[model samples]
Target chain A: MSFVQNFPFFSIILAMFSGIVSSVLSGKKARNLSLAMIVVTTALSAGTLAFCLKTGESYTYMMGHFPAPWGNEIRAGVLEGVTAVLFGVVMFLSVAGGMTHTAEDVEDSKLNLFYIMIDLMLSSLLALVYTNDLFTAYVFVEINTIAGCGLIMIRQKGRSMSAAIRYMIMSQLGSGLFLIGLSLLYDVTGHLLMSPAKESVELLVDSGSYRLPLLVIMAVVSVGLAIKSGLYPFHYWIPDTYGYATPTGSAVLSGLVSKGYIFLLIKIFYRVIGYENLVGAQMINVLYLFGVAGMVMGSVHAIQETDTRRMIAYSSVAQIGYIYMGIGLGTTAGMVAAVFHIFSHSATKALLFISAVGLYEVSGDRKDFVSLRGAAYRNPLAGIGFAIGALSMVGFPMLSGFISKLLFATSAFDSPSKMLPTLFVLAVSTTLNAIYFLRLVITLYSRRREGDKPLPPNPVKKSSRGLKFAIVCFIGLNLVLGMASQPIVQAITDGLAMFE
Target chain B: MDVSLVEHLLLNIEETVSIVLFGIGFTILLLHRNLIKKIMGMNIMDTATYLFLASKGYITGRAVPIVVDGIQDVSAYINPVPSGLVLTGIVVSVSTTALMLALTIRLYERYHSLDLDEILILAKEEEQI
Candidate 1:
């Protein structure tokens, strides 16, 4: 009845309402309005999270007062609260940092539309993370997809056009398969609300009825989301989409979009299907296989990248691998680690993208890795930000990535068979991360003079204050996430307790 | 393997057809190089999913899902849930299809080609240059 519970619905409604309102307004006004909206909503999300944590409360608000089996539901727990806060903060910071690029990268006419899509995307993401109805999840998933494509193609460049087409085709394939899975699920269970569906699913599992069809449904749904999230072999479209978009788009795509899908997968595993049922099904092995392959091969590809942005995009594929690997461990501690990695990765990647934009602008708008050589010297603030981000990504001690890796390692000890391979993959991937990330860091700080032309003064020079503040926030976020890992881990454990 | 169970499944021909449509859609999506055909494949797949959902709402002898005043017996009418879901799916699919076509237009305008392979090759060449 109070702010913590009802605000979830209000957040979504306000986002969509503002999206529509801003789409018709002038560009500058729309930008200011949307910024204000995101900031206030973010503050509210933080407030909600703090309230829930202090009260140790979780709640479910049924739509239209029909209650679960017959009505839509949205459940909020510690996990969802933290997740909403993470999504909000990263989006706010990413957009705020990339404003200069937004003004330049997107055409004037499409700016309002761009802000509209951002609002819609934020709305859909909140719903995706909160909705307890499968059909509601699916609808919001579509909204997020459409909004994501809008963000990519707003540039109207040929490369971005091709990239958008590829992205649409691939993600559509994903949603199509996802839809089919949902249809099969509904067909079998005769219910779409997660709680009822879980009841039916548990009965089926206990009775061992519809075993094969249920397994097939599980596979289809996992595969659909896997493709959407750019896991392993399905990652062909990720780089083109992230690499060619505006810097802000790349940041949002890498940091938030994939994480949203992963969050849904976590929801499906824990809430709808039940964790015990998942172990019985042996479906996590599929995730494990793809995730391992993505880690090794995705990093290898990143090492070969010529474009700086594409390199970071490829690194994302590998980071996604780590999250899936955590899922594959199929333990509560492992899931907490995975979710923690999501938070850490979002902060680090947003930092890197923002820094990369500064580097690119300093290097005369060049996106290629070669041109950015020594460009870091031209922009020291971004340079420092990127260095900190790279070190964290490489899992240096006392950084956010280190905590997640440590959690993953500790979680690995609980599952004997998973221990060795998980450790090996973790070891190898960390080294590979060092290889690519270290090389970039070295190149940034190297003494070699930037060739071909005297680079212009830092392009962010015109409005460096906000960008500088955002980068500093990134640094502080990463450090704080690393050092203050105890309470978050405890919170995650408590939140995950609600799953059972 | 009861003969009656098999017979019941066989009698449900529409779901089978939807499955077949899904197969065709996946095949087109995977094998086709033409971007438009791939988009068409995606639509076909969405249609298959919608049909699958619609069939789930079907009943052997039930009336439509329009509830009249003072109705007491619920089993007299078919399930309306899947129809509502399918309606939403159709709208989402139509909008996505529109966006895909718009992207196709932009692609064709850029590379003067409709084939995905050609676009990739050109993109790679641009990368090298």
Candidate 2:
């Protein structure tokens, strides 16, 4: 294939190298270099997406030009195409937001390391999504985790340090379990590729001896990934880290990093396990149960949270649960809904985080609902962004979240199992979403008293080209893409067809 | 001496011993209270993985995985892939250990104790902020 064909992967490597070079440069120079890197990467990703659409053919690029099965391979099929596009969108938005906010926070002393780690994290994410080899996927997972940990700890703040340490411990445990599960498959099949190992496992499914090992392996793998993905019981660390990290860093984590593992989970459970196997067994039911539980539990917790970032973090857990439920439904429609939710959530959530930065920049403190009483009136652009994002998250019709919810609800009702309990929980949670998010929306848009605390000095000027471009581009996506939801849904359906 | 029988017995013994070692390490990791000891258990489990990988590539009377001039060639060499992977794994484990140690030191500095309970209390206090 031509270099253009492999541009996505190449762009990532170049970005990381550029970041490393920029890190060593002076602060002002580094800012310019990071902005340049962001532009180049955003262009490359957008170009690759365009190419994929033009070709309408799935492409696989093997590392070192080695063939598949023996060597690692990166496959960019329909699902990857849609995800890559969404990834690019979020990345552009994040970089845009960061270009202004981060340039000011990143001192010359720490600039190089930050850029390098960011590049590594981004590259690893791309690799994780594209690679078909489970072992190679694990390597990418490590790189992502380490880079993430490094990002969080770059500041020696007590909370950042502790949170980073906790994340590192949890990640290591998850990685170990994941590696063990991979080893079990490798032992049985002598192959590291996902497809063949899955096929070989199916042949041994009937053997009682393999059942325990398989269950153990699945438990290990699922729990590990669930922790990483912030599924219900494993989601404790998310708010702590996201709440403390600079807004830009949190955006990357919630928008891109978590999605990486989540995509892998959807692929593994639905594709590798065979939908028949999953639906026939109790696994699907179990998944649905956990998902609904997370939905209810997360929403309830979010309702109680007053911290803006913490509230968003809780909402993420609940949102992930929604994605889980769609996947658990184990139908073509369900997978489509899940992927749709992923795309919509990535856009809306990034929009929210970026807006949160804008609000933080203006008001200086993001601690409580009372502090943000007239924020909407203060910055109309950020106010509308927040409102649209909140409404979309609540799954209001004509918005992106509505489609995902409708698909999920339809899939649940259509299943032979007819999981009414999960359906009820989902409805309740959506209502609860209105309770929390609407509170913020109303608080922002409401009238302020005459004696209300005066607005804090706006530290961030709305002048950076990258930030303006990122926010405007994402908001445009929210408006334009929300109307054209069918094509995105169709893309997801095509991607999920592999699982079927 | 019954050389063939001895070799067979030793091979079985190696497998059994390595499995036992892994099990013990895991048990300690699950049951331990001290965080440092838990890390020690993790190291032990890693050592078992190293042993298992090396064992997978072993053969009776085989030469080490080395490339030399013409004389040392031919069919007497062991599989090099597992050994090579094990080396990579070792380096990764070392990095993990270093990070773990750094974290432990930081925890010590914060709470002035290695006890998880005290650390949990400190974490809770920090959380209320």
Candidate 3:
């Protein structure tokens, strides 16, 4: 094996080891260590992506002496490489952007613990993307859950604490369902490694054996992941969890954490049960219906939300709905669209969250719509950043969101049964997105009313240079994804082809 | 409803019992108002899943998975993978339960209540204040 093939395994272990080491360091040192680790991982993953694209083949690295079905392994293909790169880049930018808020919101003594959680979170996300063993994925899923809870409640406020618990309960329920489904799948297929399991699944399907059990397993696992990803019916924990957490926590949780679960679900659909069998079982239709409902309902909820953070959180539900709807189309083109949307949404959402922090600082730390009037006048960079993010989300031309929407629309034409609803929801959801996000954009730039009482003097001295640099980089990332999406889409298509 | 279905369920009693237990635990988790009760429900659900997994690894008359008396036959012992998996599952559940309990303690200290609804109302009132 080439030395470059070891990058994925190295990245996971490095993040995990750094997490343990960061626990003992002082807060500032831990922050520096964590940032350095993320930067290194991003570089390594970029190298792996380059190697994979050049070689045009996927490779698996055995964890120990045992190989394949006998021992744990991590498989890195074009798709995993691209996902790891995107995750690493977005995670670094989110942490850098939200650093000021993290230091302010979390107590000084417990700051190291926050960085420790970030390291662990990054490790788990990479594992979720690259893991070849089903049981290993489950363990990392739990790790991701616990680390996410830690991130959410690190602010040490009553609201954040309550939100963390609610998130835990919902997350545990999802994992329980996932674990049981995995055990049942093992019982039927007698394999834990994904490739071997897929072989068994294909044989069982072809022979018409264990059909009912297979379908049930597929539904159970899909539902488990859907809940974890905050699908329409199971998103009760999202608003409080996202709104109450620190800015970094909100960005990472909303952008990377949920996407990690959905990516795992997509992997299971293609690698474990096989996509054809997934369609045959009619699970995609269920995902499709829920996706469409979430798209409309989540936006409606957002429209009614007065708090800016909560509105953004609700918009996440809508964005996740679009991804699931893409998957539910059950065509290769649809899958490609879904994967592309994952990248675009991660970049855009993280940008919005971090920029909201800047806007919040300028508005005397109030997050309500009314308090946010003329926020742009106070902080032009944040204002412009939020506007770019909002427009991208609203599918403006030459933005990442517009490209993903176009891909989804074109892909919908391939599936006759889903074509009309996909088009209808796409139209309605975009309009709804505009109603809230555009309004927020307009609110930020509008002058404060003359009749309103004069605001108290702002306590924050000035916005940090790190915050501005992070926002600028995020906007650059969004524009790149928007204006130059052809290469990324090509990469995604190649990765998915190598996936099976 | 069918007679043969009942007979089949009886034949696979361990699986049936575990499924029933899982359902009960899930229902409790969904319906329970108290924080501790919710944690207990999650634990019960986890235990039931372990039972299901353990039963899947058990054979009718196989020895425990060990090299005893130099017996090398594959069928001499039941599968050991699920047992290892169960051990991992137990460790994870213990940690999650500890975390939930820690968060519960924090909530109780802040709100002076263990009931979720009461705590939420108190929290909302606190936010307004």
Cα deviation at A166, candidate 3, in Å, is: 0.3
Candidate 1 achieves a global lDDT of 0.86
Q: Judging by lDDT, tell me the better candidate of 1 and 2.
A: 1
User: Model 3, range A1-500, lDDT digits (tens) per residue?
Assistant: 89999999999999999999998999999999999999999899998999999999898889999977899989999999999999999999999998988999999999999999999999999999999999999999999999999999899888898899999999999999999999999999999999999999999999999999999899989999998999998999999999999999999999999999999999999999999999888999999999999999999999999999999999999999999999999999999999999999999999999999999888788889888899988999999999999999999988899999999999999999889989999999999999999999999999999876555686334678888988999999999999999999999999999879
Error of 2 at A438 (Å): 0.5
Tell me candidate 2's interface RMSD: 2.5
Q: How well is each residue in A1-500 modelled by candidate 2, as lDDT tens digits?
A: 75667876776677667766865677557656665666676677667666766776667677776675677766666677667657766875786676666656555487566666677776777777767778778777888888888777765556776677667766766666676666555655666777777777688775535666566666767777877888887788788777777666788888888888889877777545566666655666666777788899889999999898899989999998988787778777877788788888888888888877666655655457766877777667778778888988998777788877888888777677656865787789999999999999999888766886665665334535655566677777776557888877776776676443
| Per-residue alpha-carbon lDDT of candidate 1 for residues A1-500, written as tens digits (9 for 90 to 100) | 77667877878888888899997898788888778878777776777778778888778888896877999998888888888888998898888888778878888988999889889989999899889999999999999999999999998776787788788888888888888998998888988998889999999999999998899888999999999999999999999999988878889999999899999988988888888777778998778888888889999999999787899999999999999999888888788999899999999999999888777767777776566777678788888999888899889988899999999999999888889999999999999999999898888777655464454555434435657777889889899899998988888888778765
The full ranking of all candidates by DockQ, starting with the best, is 3, 1, 2
Off by over 4 Å in 2: A1-4, A45-55, A104-106, A206-209, A270-272, A449-469, A498-500, B1-63, B67-79, B103-129
Instruction: Quote the chain B TM-score of every prediction.
Output: 0.86, 0.82, 0.96
Candidate 1 backbone collisions, by pair: none
Q: Which is the leading candidate under TM-score?
A: 3
Calculate model 3's interface RMSD in Å. Answer: 0.7
Return the top candidate by DockQ: 3
What DockQ do the predictions score, one after another?
0.68, 0.25, 0.81
